[model samples]
Target chain A: MTTFRQFMSSSSLSTVKDAGTSAIDSLKKAKSDPSKPPRYSAAGLLVKGAKSEEWPRVWREHDLKKSYDVVIIGGGVHGLATAYYLATNHGITNVAVLDKAYLGSGGSGRNTAIVRSNYLTPEGVAFYDRSLSLYNTMSSDLNLNVMFSERGHMTLAHTDSALRTMRWRAEVNKLQNINSSVIDPQEVKKLAPSLDVSPNTRYPIQGALYHPPGGTIRHDAVVWGYARGADHRGVEMHQQTEVLDIMVEGGEGPDGKGRGGKVTGVKTNRGDISAPIVVNCTAGWATLISDMAGVKLPINTHPLQAAVTEPVKVFLPTVVVSGSLHVYVSQTDRGELVFGASVDPFATYSMKGSLEFTEELAGHVLELMPNIGRMRLLRQWAGLCDMTPDYSPVMGFTPVEGFLCDVGWGTYGFKAGPVSGEQMAECIATQAVPKLIAPFELARFERGDLVGEKGAAAVGH
Target chain B: MFGTRSFSFSFERSALMMLVPCPHCGPRNNSDLRYVGESHARPDPNAVTPEEWRAYLYWEDNPAGSLRETWYCRAGCRQYFTVTRNTATNEFENHPLPGNKTGAVDPSFHYVSSSVSPSVPTTSNAAQETETNS
Candidate 1:
């Protein structure tokens, strides 16, 4: 089977032709039933001259509305999923999701798509576990094949301290009813025989925190499914719509810091959108967007670079992570070895990958598995990570009235996309911070009550 | 002869290296240095509220453009120094004289282990300009 990248590269002409034909057919069908959500199933293969080539557009184009009940910035997984949950769960369908560029073009497209809930903190574990559960039923929920391969996830511990921390994490995960435990190196080898667990190497594998339910999934499909579901529920998905500024009505707020100023609407590149509620779901540019609403967040944007090698035989059966080496590697369904590293030391908005990153990444991967040193890197890319000092997300209502935030998701945002969306929707609907995400509020910083997941974060998640 | 000459240059892609102007070692590749993040003056803990303290500890300018930052010369002088660099362009402003710099180096800048030997500043303004433009 060809990889998604390969198919896109090799069959551009045929794909475009198929898309054009299918678009025309769908447009004709839409005229008969305007409310019909585009169904993309296996039945397309039955048609003459068709070999499962044509699929309906995942989302429809939408014009900018003068006003919306809620306006969500950033058409990533979080934004689309928030819109989806708000419509389905809360009956809030008059929502508009605005994106500066194409959907899922930010961290949603750039993440390695590893899903797991083996976090250290209780708040972290509960929150991410909820996300993992949502991902478990996501394929059926959205009627889209998300391809969530639950092969398992193993985090290798190289030192005594790392091993101790793994045990701690295992206990924490177990308390949350998550099937996670610390396993011996022998058991680790049994799960993934390709791993170099020998003691001869530098920082040899002491043991591993094995979580059997954690695995990888198709990230773009998740985004598309949520977007489709949201659009089907009458939520507007506007692409290439950049939000320039957030209009705020200055007033004495409950806090009396002028934070009571209400968010009137937002001025976008397309046009002005009058929204009662404006949600900042932009990851990397979260601080910039929040600053426009007169809300300051403790977020530093840094680039996290990742690279994927040419597809080889699927020898690696599980996701392998080494926080000591500052690298994580997992093989995709199409056999490409996806590798991720820690965020860049300095803060920058530039998504340009550096040669230093490639060099260091190769060296670190070689340290973990010397056999794959010959694997040629296909391509390298970088995505901005909004690194919080405490390494946790900033969610819930900000000081600016009606302006909510779901940002500061440095590395693990992709894993927690669903839960963040559901909880963010709840927060917006009820105007009350959900218990699961209460500890992650923007006010936590002021109260000096931080949920520091820096131990499990910073490098691998 | 057909139109005005537009000087064009082919850009070479490599490691995105920043030039750190070290007092003892002069300018060096960024790989040989360690970034200490944006330097901020510590507030008086006794007087400030928890909010102010948290802001001082966690809040960062994180500007996309030029700013003064602290960097340690790990491979060279083994000294901490402050340099003005454009984060977006990765361009280092040349400090003409020692006195014109950000005074003494920040002692808080921590060094990372590196084997590279200290070298004199070899980067030129024209090279940086070319890099930024490209």
Candidate 2:
């Protein structure tokens, strides 16, 4: 079997060695006694409530610094989590996270919050399973209640091909030690009683891939937890600060057209701040951000719309998905049934919600659960997804020096946030792509070594 | 119980309806057309390098603003044509007509050059220009 380490060219290996030396030197210079946040505990909560004391701000507002060791582009879960890990795990605290809007204003706040690891590919299953473990421990680690409801996940199969794919995914997941299996219609009906599993229904449920260790999390809490944690550890969080362009020297005439030089700094709306490294964590605007550095990515931005019905009694027990129907329905703790379909048929940056989406979503959701036809939709909105040719993400080093990418997540970036941040922090500190993410390098596209996850990624989240 | 509550429908009127003008057919709902992706210039096969070939095949200038893309009138004329649209607003520019190669449909509208062109000839101002020039 070929290993990911074997795929690394000798030139990149030499670069890693050079970077390792600098990384060690920087680590030695980093502050050893960074300030910590106020610990959250039952005793503290009781004391505060008894004393009628107000809780402090979750994160502090910081003035734009002249320079930093690293600059992260987005303040979403990926960026904030990376900052948190860099501060906590690697002790690299001279990091600045810049966002054009408030934290969690983009895809971080908009995802369906479904978390699962029952993937078809071994690489995908292993990577996402690690994320699942991280999420399992995230609430306590962050000292924030992420409300992780591990109420299992189900992907229904309406056809034989879909069932065969589910079985293949189950076996692959099992080989990776993930708790996933193919269950018959009777079992699925038992799990989700609201589903119309009767043979008379349109696209009757045949079977499903049942994964017990999958469910949803409070996405906003995850973002806030990471932000507060990173902020406490001397990492700066800059909101409403838009990055205008990236400064690169000796790279195809400063246009980022060719890939040879290093990033010097970033020009933002406030001012130009110098940094040795810049990480692009912006999802919807991934292509635009990378384009500023002249590193072209094979990514297109498409809007994925989702809607929520009015709050009612919580009837749905588990997260239900159907790829053929192009819809996934999951009820929130607030008792609102959140519905999401596949991305719009065409690529456009516009995020306007359409009545057509609601109409079709109503039809599909009714087809799956005939009893929900009368449920009134309360609100609908859209978020941008940076889709790659292969449904998997593009992580780690790009062709340009000192510029790293954690983009091309498409529709499933939220669930992988924790692991992506942990690995990205490691990558930034060590200056080398980790083995787990080496298969997802941007150069893979050039080499035609694509990690195809369309089977599991599309409409499954 | 379903009939007891009167539906209070409130949605964006503009986004709910979109009209795409097909050259063969009159203006119709956008659902009548199939959206082809951004147009790209295919590299010359005989002289193209591997990197160039791959870049042409995969790399996209996915601009957030105006983009020139192809659309097939699947439900209308069953023909393909190019239109310059602002991706940010989902609005088409200058009432684009098919087979207008001269790209001066509206003198005020500037054309963004793309490799793909409409093969079908149609009655448009550009066709009249061709006739007059010939």
Candidate 3:
């Protein structure tokens, strides 16, 4: 029997009143009936002759419902993961994920996909380690190939101050049981010989912070996998449905001036959804979403630009980052050199690629590998980043009741997607903030307790 | 240092430069300048809640289009000035003319000095006394 039918059979008594017995039986037949197409697999690939364009659809489309248990905004990694965990972990399948555009069209698809846990702060290190752990088993858990590559990651330091900060990060990572350490220029050159580690360069390479368990993954696959898993568990996925505004009923909160408000529902382009609990999981447009609920955020939206070079020989084995240059480079399995830089100086919603960005990117890349200067860039693109002060994300419950935010992701949201989903699901299911993400509450800023991650996050992600 | 290779063939002329008007030295490329963050007003410390204080310290307007922001000309006559630039197009709508609030010496924004000489004194009493005597 399918997992959905098994769940239906186990929980039939409770759901019989709200969801009719006939409806449940029909849904079960839709999943378990032999007429349904087979699932994708290596053996199934051969049986279908590999050109299986006629195969089963990865996920089913559904009509919009008038109400749901939970309404999640932005069908990106965080939103989909939360819905997936809510169904599989908490047995809450009455969820709706709404997105203005197609899933993963935002930062989930734009990031360089470098995953690491070598952060400077203890809170950051612990949080990212949990994310890395979840990513390690995601393929098996989701029954989809996420293609997580744990090759390694190295952050090169070109100045004395940069090297000192790398040492600090290494120590913090060590306390968390993460495999991180500082290595000299000679060792860095040995690991990635393409790097120009010679002292004759404009900014000589001092050393690098190396983490053995850090590497890159296929970002798009992660998005699709989570979406498929969530859909399989009966979470409704709504695309091209933009949330116009969030409806909040007034009440008393921490600051008595209209702070304590309850989330009634959301006004979307499709129609109004009367959901008791609403979550803001959008990264780039987080501030705008929060404002709809009358909750202001300390977020600035900036365009973070990135580019990919034409397929070269697979040369870069590890993810390499240069803090001094504000650039990170990684080689995909398909052999394209992916490059990402820090967020643009000013806050803007426009995703227009700047010539200044391309010029500076080429200069920085050439500084690291002078031999590859001739390689042409295939195309350049930009994605919006919701930057927060202290460079940490805002997660958990807000002052508004029933309204939660998992935003201010800035540049590293893609790396923390799975863990954020798991924790946010727990927060929503239990009506209490999990301890793992308690320090990241929105009220922490009001309490003068900020988890500062700027020293480590100022560079490329 | 950036390369000297000509970019004449790659892109349009307007996109090549982020024209930052320097009060002391006319218009210059944004690469010749440094970006100071949003010029937000700090709240009085003695009479506010942590929430209000944090809002002052952290929150930003961060508009999508035109907004007034502060920038420093590091390559030219090192001075700080404010100008309105469209965050979307990265184009300067207002120029940084002379006698405009050239608060380069403003005590509130001592960027280099703040990092160089930290608020806390590092020298001991003996060294302080010796320096006083000298």
Candidate 4:
């Protein structure tokens, strides 16, 4: 059913949008309309995509040729996603996906799993919007359930300046045909009915930029589904096969293009594998791989943290983010509350979770949801984010011929995985950058073309 | 230009000595931030002695006048703000150095806050100017 707040925001009634009618009407329309054919979730696809249950976790050259048409580095979600898109979309089946560890064992598994498109910059908003739309049907498209949830996401504004930014954002989102709007205090109250909105406050939450279309999903499902689907399409998956360095010799290495400085193949632990193209999909370690190829990027690495609580009665039905509070929390299907926060000031490669972060988040979240003060936090974890100053990912062709760049995923990488892979593959196969992928070039930094997205990307859910 | 800082050259400072704040950060003693009272005065580049130039870089008169000057909040705020302190009674007004438009009042915006005219003293200048005018 259309949420009451959504009906109120729908303006067909008389004037501009009203919160109550828009919320209710949207909910009602959704209820009346039937959903399309269901997509295969990752779990569902696991049974159908794999051969029973016994693919060796780590496969080496002893079993296969240890070589292929294309070699993708890093087995993390981005790398696998790139591999999946190449195989399924581009018909490049001679591709091999390699990871230092297990699939989805990196940042992808460590995220809060929240997804949204309520971004500030047009470049950012448009890019993320496309990803969200793709994720909406990722399950059906892959014939597996990634358990894609379409609940809702909200970003609360705590100051007049922040509220003004929300209004500005609402206008920008409308320009992009997105469903985000600047909600008032009353509307925010209805959406998160149990929140404490005290007026006598520091950083008082005056309103929010409500994105009813945004929500959280399962992170692990993305890795499994992509891997299984890619494998089914004749792509090889290799785990624990750390690529030490890439070997590019005589005339532009593999894919055979650039100043005869081609990449011949990668020097991996198992053995030497020759590939026509080597796509780097490593997130935190993208710069390392780039250096191996003599390609430099504007990418720097920073780690982001997230935590979850044990199952509680379903107190939260939507994702909540207080940008001012710098805290976000949501109740998972298992009744556990998943929480995530922004990256710390400095950059580091360490994955060790910090006690200070959890304590800060708990204090902020407790201020909003006072009743949930007694709940105990179960586990906390950290993930490395390949953050760019502009908060946008870099994709498509680089200075190197056979070496394509898809680094700089950062925390938003999980939500953009499928779309990122699809576009990067298109860029490679077409020999021309896709319109959607062209704006995120690694060279945009030097040319003074920064898409500042800090205002819209906090807690990421 | 978030990391950008600006420097301003005053046409009035050479003729009438000026008072400016210490750019360095210091303690609660306030005086821990010393002022180089009447240095930076310039004769034409060719006319002055190297010692005269040295004195410009090192000396002071902290003279009194309708003199342009710099003022520092040596006691309270640690910011390096400049002000015009009348040397007569050590009575002076403070203003940020110019060209840093975003942080300083724009002579161009003389229209909006007419209450703060170009002729008026800054917050630091207001009391002393009021006392002098009285």
**What is the per-residue lDDT of model 2 for residues A1-461, given as tens digits with 9 covering 90 to 100?**
55667657555666665655554444334324224435666555554565676666778887999999999999999999899999999999999999998999999999999999998788888899999999999999988899999999999999898899999999999889999999999999899998999999878899999999999999999999999889878999999899988998778755644488689999999999999899999998898889888898988777888999999999999999988787899999999999988777667776777788888788888999999888999999888888887788999998779999999999989989999999999999999888888888999879778898988964642
Please list all clashing residue pairs in model 2, or write none if there are none. A256-A294
Candidate that beats the other on DockQ, 3 or 4, i.e. the better one: 3
* Model 3 chain B poorest ten-residue lDDT run: B125-134
What does fnat come to for each candidate? Answer: 0.45, 0.46, 0.41, 0.00
What is the C-alpha lDDT profile of model 4 across B39-73, one tens digit per residue? 13356668976655443432222221333433234
> What is the DockQ (computed on Cα atoms) for candidate 3?
0.18
Give the alpha carbon lDDT tens digit for every residue of A211-269 in model 3: 98999999999999998888878898998888988888875533221278888899998
User: Residue A409 of model 2: what lDDT?
Assistant: 95
Model 3 TM-score is 0.82
Give the Cα error of residue A53 in candidate 4, in Å. 11
Tell me which residue pairs clash in candidate 1: A253-A260
Per-residue CA lDDT of model 4 for A1-461, tens digit only, reads: 89877776764333332433453454346346422112223332343344353323222232446568888887766777777788777888888888777788777788888888877778877888988988898887666567878888888888787788889888899899999888887887787777887886555778988888899888888787787677656778887777877876654544333344677788877888888689898876776677677665655455677888979788677788887677788889899998887664333344546566777788888888888888899988767677665677888776667888888876688878777888888877788888887888865755556676756676432
Candidate 2 has an lDDT of 0.80
Residue B83 alpha-carbon offset, candidate 1, angstroms: 3.0
Worst 10 residues of 4 chain A by lDDT: A35-44
Candidate 1 local distance difference test against the native: 0.79
Q: What is the lDDT of residue A237 in candidate 2?
A: 96
Q: Please report, in order, the local distance difference test score of every candidate based on alpha carbons.
A: 0.79, 0.80, 0.78, 0.65
After superposing candidate 1 on the true structure, give the runs of residues whose Cα lies further than 4 Å from its correct spot: A1-31, A48-55, A251-258, A458-461, B1-16, B93-134
